[model samples]
Target: MAQPDVPDCPVDALTAECLSRIFSHLRPADLAAVACTHRAWRQAVAGEEGLWRAHCEAEYCLRSPHLPAGGAASGYKAAYGAWRSEFGRYGELAGRALRAWRLVEDWTAQHFPAVAASFGMGASEAELDAAEQQLGFALPPALRVLYRVHNGQELQFDRLVDIQRTAAHESIFHGMFGGYSFYSHLVSCRMLPLRRMVKWTRTAHTQLDFPRGDKRALFAASHNFNKMVYCDAADGLVKIACVDKENCLQAVPADAAGDPARDGALRWFEAYAAALSSGAFAVEALDAENPATIGICLFPQLPPGRSEAVTEGVRVRACPLLIPELTQVAEGERQYFFAYSIRFSLLPEEEQAALRGTLAGPAGGAPLESVQLRSRYWRIRDAAGQVVNEVRGEAVVGHYPLLRPGEGEFAYQSCTHQREPAGSMEGSFRFVEGSLQAPGREFDAVCAPFRLDVPDFIF
Candidate 1:
């Protein structure tokens, strides 16, 4: 009774949910073609608002201002078009930046909500346009996305770290990016708000001397010192001002770290995310009494830049941090400064059982009460692997810290000079198993090599 069997269209056989999922993979144009073939496909494309919503989230990341639900394109499909018209210049990059920033913000929100709160709300298109207009040149695509995400830090809160704010803020000595203390220098780096950034850029003509035709822009600075961050608009290379050098700036290429790039802003943020994911930074309280001022330290807490070694029962962990605020280029020689942290400790009593062979006590093979550092040695090398200098000293910073068993680390920081942007430091400490007054047999505790190079990313 039936004629020859009729074939069913494969797409027609799919449920609406399945069709929506498949359409998710296709571009808007491809989906449009499917809509023309049949009424079912057309309904799926036009009626499923969630499909278009997914597309919006995938592309814009909400970097564009929200369109009212009742606006011309209330449907997500239509909203997508409206956003494209306005904020599509760096949509892909903006989306990626937004995601990475969310990760960093989430970390701050969890550990230091005060700093997170200091982040400015996203800059509007009009505001960004005005800044670029006054800046006299268009912002690079990398920076445009950053401004859209956050207009930099709020100065009042920013001063809590960069400047000597009122004592009311407590011993809080750090900002969003931490600072190091050496001699009398106490400095922290912070992002400049849009207003300050504009002012700094304008004042460069008078306050700071730049070579004629030079167009490097300043976006960040330390309040108490000449430490500043600059960017070349011509190419998005981020640089730090070398106050001691005439018209010289040090590179701080944040993306691909050390590999120079044309775009700096987005790469800068990407480098931060990489540092955070790599555990190169930590959120800690600058002042124990003020939890609100907890801030991030850019010092590397792991790998290539951080080194660890153990000899007998003594353990040494060392790391280096480039001091951008102290860069200087003078007299045919460039001097970059680095602050290094050396953390040494003796193994706990329980863990020391493995080292008893070399550390056995005189009475019953028990471990010694402590180890006394006698001398220290440092080997410094330039990026070329050539030895530049060696240091042999009686004691570190004029103190022979006793490494008592099972106690916490005896940590201190000192700085050194490197002629180039990159170099390495490795050393060993001569120690005795007993106290300084009653010394035992001497041994060397190795300090693994650690990097002393300008960071791929500043904080």
Candidate 2:
């Protein structure tokens, strides 16, 4: 058979628009290959922000089925709506401040019962007066209202952990056991069933060891309790562990032998439990002290386009955003931006097979071949749009063994970092003959550029 006349011009001869239109018809992986062809092809694809947005939208919709459409637009709106409904506007500032004041008032009343009785109403009233006299600063309007409505008391978890078995075990085997064994760890803490309401008391303290640096210690305290809060979406939950003290002690260790230290620690746990039961401590204060708490709630945004199936199978559309602003607790202090990739599977096996066959290989199977398609490397740009960080990489593709008539699946690997915010990767594969022969042919792969954004922590 005579081969079609080779074009006089190079593949780069195609116009940018014409190239993009053709590239768009290819699968994402194939389109990437096209970019590796040359600088011009890369520029055509790299300039398109819409492509990245489409990927993000598809992932979001898959993860959050209840979320509305319009992709990222709908997802963001839904997240904001939930935030407002739960905490109200300016909730982060006002709600936190108000909650803090209420907690302080309650703490004063419980620890200073004598003074509280003198004031007739309780310690909260006296504490408020003392704050005004000492700080010479009036509480904010919202805070004052919150204090008036909520007399100081430890807020209880909607549920608490049951420790009856743990308490019994401790009482029965007091002297025989010095510390919890590995197998008995969860049982000793009464955490086996993973109950939502059960709470266990444990003491956590820090010890400064000369060579070892600062070592933090955590042990089951006499009356302290920990609650488990779960999040099905994140596939994990946070445990809110708390403790309190009637009078501050210098310090104590879990393995301490001295009766005085152990007695003081136990007393503190008793008081802490009392505070929690009586509603003396504020939940906001505890949360602020442990911002990295696993219990903190997270709200995720969804992606664009509804699920659809073509001859190739189902296509899931999603969009993901990289919010550098939320990457760290201290803004701009962190090196990497935190972002998530959104993905969803929409097609059945039959459709997926059809799509793969149409997209994977060249038109005629004259012993399959491979080729390079596209590559895009980007640099971090400054405010004025000057490239700052030099980022580069290439994409390639090539022929492989044909599948048996009924076999449709193929396996390949790509190395992409799940952490680094900026960098590039590139490489190529060559054909091999049985044993050790060379089949002088090669193919190209595509490298796509993307940025990471940290999603919002709504709760």
Candidate 3:
């Protein structure tokens, strides 16, 4: 006994907004079904762009499809359909790849904005197929997803020497992935686009002893003569082609590389992303006063890879770097040359106030009126915990830095040879509250114990 005034369909009585809200929880396939039900249902569902956008975001982790140029989201429904057709097979892997890049891009935006902008747009299926066809092989599943997310980075500068000169002047254009700079050279690493990667692979094979039926391609490299990173299609290993001596290839140990069977390119990308998330790497300002001096550096920010402490609002971060090139092993004699960097800075009053209760000495505390490096005391020990060398020095490498609050850390790198394969360094630095010229209150900034062991991953 339906009333004459009542509408025949339930949706006829409901507003479009309510219908849209109900449709939001439905899957894309179900929503498409709703669209085909009747003219009223189709009209109600067809125009709800938010619903389609939400589905795209949830499934692909993309804010916009940005398809067919002009960024016309006039039809998010079209965008969702396009994404499904393009990347549906990748599924969870595509989402993971997107999320990984998002993390790296976020870090880059916060620290080095220009470099973040250098990342190339994703490659299409046709482009990827062309690359594969040219190479006579296929990219791995995970790697395929990565390329579909971002082809790679295009370095903006001309050469490594330019980057070196820029860094020497304390001006840096971070490229690819931001790298650490010291002394005369800047070793900025950048990812190569697929086309460039293919070209480099051909060059590498031609330069080296070419192997038949093998696909070893250079995927990334420093702008200079550091090391070239490669992906092996035959074996899922991300390797570094060492240029020194025999030019031996070194793959990251399985211990550091999770799930060895996974595609090396994807593993490398995910590992880099993990490093950013875990504080193993940080983008920091090279100079304290110049915010523009910020760049990406591989100075570890967490324990194991790094040791840190704050004394009287001054923070000291020390990390060890393994020089595999200098590593010597011969009959009962194993020598490992390790270089360590000491970066210390006096915290600004405002930062100290902000870090109160969170950081050690700054907890509801006071900032240093002034600080100057005076001397260093380091106790280097071997793997057996026996003291190898005890260094008591007036100034680190001959410069006593006059620390200033809010100015960047005074960073220095020095090499030390260890008798054993592994060792540990524990030390402290003497600093005066005022300048070295004008003596005032003094304190010993503790340099927490840090390891000198060779890492599984030799980057």
Best by TM-score: 1
For candidate 3, write residues 102-186 as lDDT tens digits.
8888877776677778777888888889988988787776778887878887654433443554334232335445555444434
Better of 2 and 3 by lDDT: 3
Q: Which structure is stronger by TM-score: 1 or 2?
A: 1
For all candidates in order, the CA lDDT equals 0.69, 0.28, 0.70
The C-alpha RMSD of each candidate to the native structure, in angstroms, is 6.6, 29.3, 7.0
lDDT of 2: 0.28
lDDT of 1 by residue, 1-459 (tens): 433333334454457778888888888768777777766677788877777787777776543335522235557877777666656767467667767777767776876676677778777788878988887777676776676777777756345544645544422343555555544555556667777788777786456666665656677666553677777776776777665524445455434545343567677667766666556777653322334544675556788778988777788899788776566766685788888878888888776776565532222357657889999999999998788899999988787999888887776678887778888988899998787799878888889888887765654
Candidate 3: pairs in clash: 288-407, 288-408, 357-363
lDDT of 3: 0.70
Instruction: Choose the strongest candidate by lDDT.
Output: 3
TM-score of 2: 0.22
Please give the ranking of all candidate structures by TM-score, highest first, separated by commas.
Answer: 1, 3, 2
Each candidate structure's count of clashing pairs: 0, 65, 3
